[model samples]
Target: MDSELAAASQWATESNAAVFIRLKTESGVVQAMDSEEGDEEENEEGEGADVIEFHPEFTYPIYGEHERIFGYKGLSINLNYAAGSLATYFNIKYTKRIEQMESTSTVALKADDIDTPMRQILADSVCATQSEFAQQVVHDTRVFRPSGRKVHEYAGRSSQTEQLRYEIYSSSFNDTESAKYHERMQAFVLFFIEGAQFIDTSDERWHVYTVFERLDMNGQTSYSLVGFSTVYNFYCWPDRKRARISQFLVLPPFQGQGHGSALYSYIHAMVLGNSDYADLSVEDPSEAFDDMRDRNDMRYLLKHNAFAHIKGARVEQSAISELQHTHKLSRRQMTRCIEMALLKMIKSVKSQEFGEFRLFVKRRIYAQNMDLLQALDPDERKHKVAESFASVVDGYRRVLSLL
Candidate 1:
């Protein structure tokens, strides 16, 4: 077992490989040939012991790359454990051919063409699920003011009603020099909006697309359409499952209003109504169905009820290590790690009060939670931080939900 593992590790190091196991038995002639080697040579005074001739019965190869990689080693040990006399020898072969294929077949995400209206619609549709206001805007097309007047109108307004007319296109970011930049801007945006992450980004299991909204205001203008992505997980029982979402953003100025809701409505309609994308069915009925049904009812009410119900809750507790890791905090230790780091940086310049430092950390954490800056002392910085945080957190939250 140790020798086989060493060989596999060595092979993997040389070729970037994965391993599996295989089992086989020797043939009759081969077994006889092997047994003949064990016979004692003929002695001067005595005839050689009766020449024992035995051979293996049969042999078969296991299918699949996994078998070839790991099964070979497992078979070696299994054969060795077959007590009594030597039964069979499991052959292990190291192949560079398989490794090359694996390296070449890695799946990658590329930017979609953002030049068409349909693409924009798809992106926006995906994004809508993330932001309630964006959802509403996509659905209604007409944005309503606080007074219930159609004050802000999107493109494709015919007379008074807003029409949904968008297209999708394909683009590539491979030309981008920095892989991280392309991933952060393009791939991460999709994953973040979809509320998921890729354990292996090279795997071809993820599909990403972007939509660009077309505005025909005298001339023409295009806004970044919401991006959408889906992951194919075959491990789930029975059917292959995929989770998808629409528009994931509300432009800074266009936010606060009910555009997000409209976008979400459009996404719900798309997901539930369309067959080409994803299939939404309740799973684990006793657990998820009740809550899902309630949420669905609430959605219906929000659309119909004049007096809508809105609840706001704030939770403050010690951050767990997993939570910190998920949030991308540097320190593994939770208590005072972030706060202490901030204090050290502040004190490096001058003596800062503990209260002021605490406020700064609280604001930073709060901004992360709310997806917006709530600081008033530095209005410009506060606004910038808030907007940036909101944009990122919205995308993050959307993708997280999908996962």
Candidate 2:
């Protein structure tokens, strides 16, 4: 009896492993549609179409912490989307399903119903049938324009050293037409971003910034969705607004090609250019985003005449306040950028200038954690502060190297 139970338990499959996600262009959908009436079953990448495949980074939100589906052998879930408009088709395949009523002189073993959770996750935006999905993909891709007015355009670096044109568009959530399409694309946030939730589109203050690749092929032009950022406008005390970036994501296929930097730069410029916004902030940034933000902010500050002599100077409150007013940055971020600038000025870590810079950073770290340090003895507190200062310096070095 124990041996039989052990054998049945071996059939559990990891949910992340069993799931496959693909982004297909209109040409790929046309190829699939032309083959047969219901030809979306196969999971192969068809020729002459740009089909990108990637897996979910985290599935604990959809599945349990174990992220395992039991009582199934060779379970596969396929999620296909139209790369432009993000129309979705979901399907599941399994080689063998365990019998729920097996008589092993014990309770019956049951298999997890994978479709129920997925249906809820996809929401009403997913098509009910594969044929319906095909028709929707064709129609949506043909008419799909990014949900906003084009605000900026720049060039991207591809692996082949080709300079590709990219455009950034801005839209508000109050636009009903764009909000409907944003609903279809929202599922990607759950798949790619950890601890991310769907936004409430009813609020008129929400805005979306999207990045798309401008593809011109055979005398026809099309735009493919690359990544996007969501920002919310918060009311300031004195008839002003504060902009906070809630979520930002760049698809895995186009991640390392400098697209994200371009998108962030555009948003940063837009926020600063608008006189109505008092400042700009981020809701909850991941470590990767923090590093990217640091590099970009430092780069921008370096271009200003006021920031030219900021290196190795005391990070005074007046200086911070003045820069914050002009740049619309939070005090904490402004302080960190100043530290980065100071570090960049030091010619060598072994020099006297590096010691002054290290002490400057230590002062800020100690002040930030003063409450906690008050409880510890003097030597222990000093040691802890030193550790924190070293970590901050290391982080600064990493960001500066990237710049």
Reference-based TM-score of each model: 0.24, 0.91
lDDT tens string, model 1, 1-403? 4554444443322111221111111122223334456442211111122112111111111122222222121121111100111112222232222222223234331212112322221212222211232233233222211111111223433433233333332222332322222243332232123232223445444333333343333342223232222323232244434333322443222334434444443444444443343333222222222223333323443344311221111113433344333322223122233333333334333344544554554565555545334344467665665575455334333433432
Prediction 2 global C-alpha lDDT: 0.81
Question: Number of clashes in every candidate structure?
Answer: 62, 0
TM-score of predicted structure 1: 0.24
Tens-digit lDDT track of model 2 for 47-112: 444677788886777877788888788788888887877788898888898886454657667888
Candidate 2 to native Cα RMSD, angstroms: 2.8
